[model samples]
Target: AQSVTQLDSQVPVFEEAPVELRCNYSSSVSVYLFWYVQYPNQGLQLLLKYLSGSTLVKGINGFEAEFNKSQTSFHLRKPSVHISDTAEYFCAVSDWGGGGADGLTFGKGTHLIIQP
Candidate 1:
């Protein structure tokens, strides 16, 4: 099993302003890290992921994350945020891939509050 930690429980940002949500994971084996966004009354949406190759990974809605092996972190960041971006973001990790039945250790979500 893998372990992850989200540094903050809430992050308040103004619309059109930059924002970052911190996440850290502990892995003893090769692992994949993921970021997901959950909107009100909606399922989780994939934000980004770090599997291999380059440390920087980008995803839908202009979200991105940099995998730092040294820091053991994959913090999600967006250059600018919209009021619609307000949601709960989560960080998760799994060793040994495949979507279904594969266990992913998830960290507590960070609520992103987009303000006008």
Candidate 2:
């Protein structure tokens, strides 16, 4: 079984500033990690993912996350953020055996509040 934990419930950052959202996970077997963003009144969108190969994976909207196996962490980071970036971010994990059938387990989510 795999589970994701988002350390922060909310993150407040000024527009154009850098930010990092902490995420940790625990699993008995290897699993794929992902980050998804949900804007107000919208569905969740895939931000980035770490399945294999490179430890550092980049995704849409200038966002990236590093897969640290030793620490069991996949933290999201952005160099600069825009007001449009403000949304609810969720960290998710799924095992390869599931193959999209079981779906992913997600964290509680972190509200990214971009302040002026």
Candidate 3:
């Protein structure tokens, strides 16, 4: 079964500090990589995706991630985080070839705490 795992359940950091949310996946077939962010009662927004080509992918809100094929990992990183960055981040994966689950399989979730 194709699955994604986030290493951290929560990451606390002071305002303007750097942070990283680790994500790993195991899939027998091709897949799409994604990072989604949810703020409070709001819905999630697409941060970035790695469909094909390029190992390092940049995302919204000053965030980025690198896809490591050998390690089967895609870890999110932000050079500097702000208080507004406090939210829940989810790592997801979807079947690239279709016929599988159309929707994403999300990680448990990582609560990003940005303290001022």
Candidate 4:
């Protein structure tokens, strides 16, 4: 079975500062990587993904992450964050089994607190 683990449950940062949310996964087969952001009482939006090609992947809202295969880690980073960046961030992965399954498994989620 595949699973994801978020290193931190919460990250606090001041407005205009930077932040990083750590994520790790365990899978026996190859898979796709994705990051999602969810605002209060809202559904998740795709932040970024690591499909094929470059390990460095960029996402919306000035967010980016690197796919490290050896470490089995994908850490999200934002150089400068804003107050509006406050939300819940999730690290997810999808399989390529073509089993037509839901193809999505997410971490518990990390609360991003952006201080004004």
The list of candidate 2 runs beyond 4 A from truth reads 98-101
Q: List the lowest-lDDT window of 10 residues for candidate 1.
A: 95-104
Q: Kindly report which residue stretches of model 3 are placed more than 4 angstroms away from their true locations once superposed.
A: none
Relative to the unseen true structure, what is the Cα RMSD of model 3?
Answer: 1.1
- Give one digit per residue, the lDDT tens place, for model 1 in 1-116: 57899999999999999999999999787788999999989998888888899999999999999999999999999999999899999999988654554577899999999999
Pairs that collide, model 4? none
Candidates' TM-scores?
0.93, 0.95, 0.95, 0.96
Task: State each model's CA lDDT, in order.
Answer: 0.91, 0.95, 0.92, 0.93
lDDT per residue for candidate 4 within 1-116, as digits (tens), equals: 79999999999999998889999999988889999999999999999999989999999989999999999999999999998899999999988756777478999999999888
Tell me the tens digit of each residue's lDDT in model 2 across 46-95: 99999999999999999999999999999999999999999999999988
Candidate 2 structure, TM-score to reference: 0.95
Q: Write the per-residue lDDT of candidate 3 for residues 5-93, one digit (tens) a residue.
A: 99999999999889999999999888899999999999999999999899999989899999998999999999999989999999999
Query: Candidate 2 overall Cα lDDT vs. reference?
Result: 0.95
Clashing pairs in 3: none
User: In terms of TM-score, which candidate is stronger, 1 or 3?
Assistant: 3
Arrange candidates by TM-score, descending.
4, 2, 3, 1
